[model samples]
Target: MVTRGTEILVIKRNDPAWPGLTFPGGHVEAHESFHDSVVRELKEETGLTIKKPKLVGVKQFYDDDDHRYLVFFYTAHDFSGKLKASNEGQLFWMTKDELQKQKLAYNFDRDLPVYFNDNLSEHILDGKRDELF
Candidate 1:
């Protein structure tokens, strides 16, 4: 997550695999750590450089296509650079209230509370194909 003040950077995806408003992230490439992948994915998707992205949660589920998906949910507070749009779709910053009004991608609604509630720890969320985007 790329954050400034109370707003967060999110991408409106174009990929059918996962389409809609969501945080910028992708598959962790071979030979790259999760931390490095987050930095790279953030740049590729939103043109931002972030550091020390702490692991917030892990979302594991299968999509409508029956493909298993394991997502590493991260939150970054320190970052730099101007935002840019990619093939992923558009990049936008929204406050919590604004975000609450938007149509989120699939089960992201289940992840929101953990992000807003400080007491929540790194969690493993499991679901089935019916819960996908």
Candidate 2:
């Protein structure tokens, strides 16, 4: 996940799952550290070249489609580039307060507040999605 100021960056996904409001990240490449993957995925999805982001947490999801994902969450204090939308979907800069006002994609309400409160690291690292609520 990438955040600008108090606002978090969320991608409106084009796929079947949720199809909107996802963190800016994806699968880690071979031989890549989780941190490096976060940077790479951010650039690929958001078109922003971020400085070294601090590791916050990891989220693993399991769905009926045999879907499994381990998402590495990070926070960046600085970055350099223009914002461009990726094939994933549109990008929105949502402040913590503004989040409740918009039509957020599913599950975002479960996840984003953790990121906003900076408690994402502990929950994710512990594989505690169920505890989020």
Candidate 3:
């Protein structure tokens, strides 16, 4: 999920998944709302508490190596708790333009820009239907 406040928070996964400069999120747990997953992921990965995470967009990524991922994006305006280094990676806030320049795990190159401009409704209704990456 994409947790956006004034700045974007990204993490480098310590595991095999794309491990550099990625949106802080993960799998949707059993019986959990997508929104709650966003909150839970943020808190677990970054130690932050968030309120009202807005759904942003959904997108998929497919790699030549046969790795694929589907992600639900979300944004939070209100948050508390201190930022500490977790197993995920270093957390940092950056402007949208700055994000474009980072070595973002592949899919972000195509999807995140769309999210920055589009409203939540457009994203929910039509975003995931296409392959942004």
Candidate 4:
């Protein structure tokens, strides 16, 4: 998450499966560290070049079919770039209070709050998907 003052940056996804308001990120390429991937993904999805990004946590999700995936959550307290929206979706800033008013994409509700509350630890969890996997 990239925060501008009291608000944080989020993307409105266009793809299925947890599509909606979520962080700007993509799959990490082979041999790429989570740090590099977050920076690259942020640029691709939001056109923002971040600085000194910190890892918030690593969350693992398990679906009903036993399919699993992992997400490396990150936060950037400082950055440099112009805001530009890509093919992914719209980009916007909202305070933590405002977040409670909007409908988030998926596990954002369960995961991101930990970071906002000053917890820097990692986490692993099972996902709750309304649809069949």
Candidate 5:
């Protein structure tokens, strides 16, 4: 997530698999570090260069085919360049309160605590019954 003051950078995802509002991120490429991937994805999707993205937590789940997926969550306060949207979706800024009122992506509501709460570190969805743990 990218933030400035009380506003957060958000993306209304166009991808059919996960369509709704969420933060900017993508898959980690081969031979790339996690931190570097964050920087690259932000630049590619949001037209911003992020610095020192502190890995705050992670969100993990499994697909219908039992393929495990892990989303590394990071929060960055230092960023540069003008904001722009990619094929992923539209980009905009919103406060925590404003975000709560918007249509969030699947399971994103359950994932919010990990980003806002200092005590939480992970959002895990045990695929069986779609329960949060």
Candidate 6:
């Protein structure tokens, strides 16, 4: 998440597999560090160069093939760049209440606590249920 005052950055993804409002991020590239990947992805997807993005939480689930998929979540309060949207989606800044009203990407709503709750560091989704830790 990238924030400026009361608003947080969000993307309306064009990806068919997981389309709708969600934070901007992408897969980690081979040989890249997790921290570096977050910085790179934010730049590529949102045209922002984030500095010192603090890792806040993670989301994990299994794909259709039963392979574990992990999403590393980070929050950045310091960044600089003209806000622009890439092919991934349209970008917007919305407050928490405003964000709650928007259509979120698949399971993203369920994943929000991990981002907003200081005590929660992980969200796990099994095929049958959701778990937080």
**Candidates, ranked, lDDT:** 6, 5, 4, 1, 2, 3
lDDT of each: 0.78, 0.72, 0.69, 0.78, 0.91, 0.94
Expressed as tens digits, the lDDT of each residue in 1-133 for candidate 5 is 8999999999999999899999999989999999999999999999999999999998888877888899899999999999989999999999999998999998899888889989888887866654333
Assess candidate 5 and give its lDDT: 0.91
Stretches of model 4 off by over 4 angstroms after superposition: 127-133
TM-score of candidate 3 on Cα atoms, chains taken together: 0.75
TM-score of the candidate numbered 2? 0.78
User: Which candidate model has the greater TM-score, 4 or 6?
Assistant: 6
Query: What is the TM-score of each predicted model, taking all chains together?
Result: 0.84, 0.78, 0.75, 0.85, 0.94, 0.97
Candidate closer to the true structure by TM-score (higher is better), 2 or 3: 2
Give the Å shift of residue 108 in candidate 3. 1.5
Model 6 stretches astray by more than 4 angstroms: none
Tens digit per residue, CA lDDT, model 6, 8-85? 999999999889999999988999999999999999999999999999998889988999999998999999999999
lDDT accuracy of residue 124 in candidate 4? 60
The alpha-carbon deviation from the true structure for residue 79 of candidate 5, after best TM-score superposition, in angstroms, is 0.6
Better model by TM-score: candidate 1 vs candidate 2? 1
Most accurate candidate by TM-score: 6
For model 3, the superposed segments whose C-alpha errors exceed 4 Å read: 1-6, 61-70, 119-133
Q: Which residue pairs in model 3 clash with each other?
A: none
- In model 6, the number of clashes is 0
Candidate 1 matches the true fold with a TM-score of: 0.84
